[model samples]
Target chain A: MAETTWRPASARGAGGATATTRAWRVWSSAAIVTAVVLAVLVVPPVVNLDEQAVHLADKLLPPSWEHPFGTDDVGRDLLVRCVYGLRVSLLVGIVAAVVATVVGTAVGALAAACGGWVDRIVMRLVDVFASVPHLLLGIFIVAMFRPGVWPVVISVGLTHWLSTARIVRAEVLSLRSRPYVDAAISGGASRWRVTVRHLLPGVLPQAGLAAVLMVPHAIWHESALSFLGLGLPTHQASLGTLVQGARSSLLAGDWWPTLFPGLFIIVPTLAIAGLAGAWRERINPRRRSELML
Target chain B: MLELRSVTAGYDRRDPVVRDVHLTVAPGEAVGLLGPSGCGKSTLARVAALLHRPDRGQVVIDGEVARGWRHRAPRAQRTAFGVVFQQPRLSADPRLTLTQLIAEPLRATGRAAEVPGRVADLARTVGLGDDLLARRPHEVSDGQLQRACLARALVLDPRWLICDEMTAMLDASTTAALVAAVEGYRARTGAGLLAVGHDKVLLERWCDRTVHWDELSGDAAADRTT
Candidate 1:
């Protein structure tokens, strides 16, 4: 291995993989979809909505030709407020989801693969987290840390990964029993090779599904935290804070402020969760077929 | 040479499947192990093949204790032995084709550039034709999958081969063909073989010497005759 840096044999074109379809799913096929998801995700942060432009003269206007969603209290455009709120929500969702999934998958793989006290301890920790209310934990995390994107990300990301970890642990447990892993290890293939080649390819689909599902959870958590003033500061408007701020106007019958931002939150949460199912089917070869999307 | 000294291994702590077993396969020699269905010969082969960690006992290979299990053996040590299981389809990765499967050890040894040629050569040696190389595990029959698994096992040109019930699922005709392939491989490479099988005639025919699982164990009253 010293004289020549080892390349994985598949890279040598020995198998002619493209010539036929194999049992495992191909991740690269999702490049088009993931790219589109990324593009839409990138849009929220870059497209500034000038949410802070307050016009006292144009205060409390209803949805009209000038403002599609109308103006909010203190005369900020509801469209701008909802959009900037979406920006913060997406940032928190994406970042927190990634961190949670990566950590969860790694921990789950280790706990299940190692098996014994390590497995017991990890599962017990998961149980502990499960027993506690996620909202309470998220609140505690935000309050303990500085109020910013990181805190929201950490709170939402950290609390939400238990499901992913549990899911991966179960999958890895079954995968460990599969003869291919044993064959690979027994054939003197290094543990790393067995893990990277055999184990992870199997675990990734479920883990990925969890990560996608986590986005909505993170977004919701961030919004909720911001509602309680534990999420992003009042100066930086997120979906949660925007909705929270509109609570007063809601009772006054000026419902546009609450209604518009709330739609932004609900619509995205539903869309992401719905899309997660299709994403799951597309990535798993056994389930891959003409999805009626 | 491969040696097992009182090697005992089991999945459960209360009941050891293979206990206090002693066996050896000399260099360039073919040996056969036969027993009833549940006599623990497969576990013994697994231990000798450096796949299973023994509870107590040592596996000495070519005068050194084979450093496998926890600490990895050197590249030379790793390439010195090949182990094949009874269920070829189960052992082989369904995701990979025969070519990629056969080329795994070569890839591990940093000789990935030689994989295509090596895969073809191994295919010929194992009686797996060139066209079967592109097919997945499910695409082939049990016989063909066995041949692919055998080719993969021998790809590293291992000095020793451990085949545990390798032909149990094959038809009589396929078994004959597989035997010929094993024989051909041995003739060319002079590799040692430890083959376990249910067929007494095949074992007797292929191996230089045949030993029963009872003979290797410490049990005094194992009265079954072969």
Candidate 2:
């Protein structure tokens, strides 16, 4: 065997205190800054409704200092409307993601803990849900309810939980075989105690990753539903509705309205995915030492 | 007394690893189980520890037959013995510090208030330094982590102790220190001990009576009891 060397623990950096030089940090920070700006713009008093008022004389103006995203055919400031639209989309996405994560984690943890036939049955149910394409199922569900925020949120949340459920179930199954879990049981811990103390904490990172990644998907799902005129009222400023209303202008040689909203959706999705990747590396015990302190 | 009567157990029921094993350890006595690697000694040790249920026969603890295994065992039966395994790293939770690891049993058994003092006392007994108690398993050497595992095993002060190749992965000096700690605990509490190891000379020195795996076959072996 080749000669081996050992280093003192002190020589290695602290686990999470280390600086990360990954390229994704730049994009993640930019995304966070954009989200914060959009949040500020959504504050009730900060948002000026006059920008959304009809000024037909100034209609179809291209991008400029006065109206950065230009005026729509009805003369509403495209920037203000897009910001409001993004705010609605973000709110719906987050609420839906939370709902999905909670349901998925509970179902997965239950299936794994119960094991035997219960596990097989829950996994089969997951397979059934996963077999159907998310967009089609989401649209089908949304079409049943009145076009509104909660209906869209419920539809997106219900359709997206299958992936999270699968991830958490796999994670919990792996964690079940860990020796520490056996040690906990041998130490006189009840099933519930072991589940709460060991199994749940072990699965949190993977579950959090699932939730973060689900946000972008949920946003797009809501957008698709809205664009199909099956989500949020037509007057509500959502990225989907804005994009849907801008379709005529987009084909009429005016593209700012459609272009800006499209960028708003794509940029944040990429940023969040990037941030989740960084988070996965940070929390992973095996690869944690590889990070610089 | 801790006794395994006609026990037959293995991972697979149809092909049991260790069969019809009979062993007993009286209070204050250390019984070393000596066998070569893959000779089913560890499997026997697990059966003796009540961590694994026997395919037949019974595990009689303090004259009472244990009716359950693992977490299903009665609280008194479950808490009656403390066990230490071969690999400390695999046995301990990575997220916990040495203090939390050692205090796990105390916390689990609802003796929460006694954790700090008991863990500190056991750490000293096992020769684990205060500085080492704050570190996780990955942050410490094999010897340091094994010392913590020993401390964890002895923290509950049970009537019985089971060491299943506990020092096999450790160096000689660590092995000596851990054996001394177990002996010291036994002397104080008069606890019955079942030390499972392949090292014949070490077992002869540490235990009151050492038994070979093959000797545990028939009724004749039970007659050689001390």
Across all candidates, what is each one's fraction of true contacts kept? Answer: 0.37, 0.58
Summarize candidate 2's per-residue lDDT along A1-293 as a digit string, tens digits. 99987656533433424244454364565667477455635554576565458889988899999999988888888888877887789889889999999899989998998788999998999999999988899989988988899999999999888878888888889888776676676677787777778888888878887787788888888888999888988888888988898899989989997998888787776676556656666676345422210
Model 2 docking tier (incorrect/acceptable/medium/high): acceptable
lDDT of 1: 0.79
Off by over 4 Å in 1: A1-49, A64-68, A113-132, A144-146, A277-293, B66-78, B129-131, B220-226
Clashes of each: 0, 2
Clashing pairs in 2: A18-A293, A85-A237
TM-score of chain B taken alone, every candidate: 0.92, 0.95
Candidate 2 deviant stretches above 4 angstroms: A1-52, A143-145, A281-293, B54-57, B217-226
Cα lDDT tens digits, model 1, A72-92, are: 778888777776778778878
Error of 1 at B83 (Å): 1.0
TM-score of every model?
0.80, 0.84
lDDT (10s digit) by residue, model 1, range B1-226: 7899878788875788987788889989999999888778887887777666778788999899976653255656655767778998788888888888888777866779998888878787777887888998999999999988888788777898888999999998888877788778888999999999777888999899999887886553244342
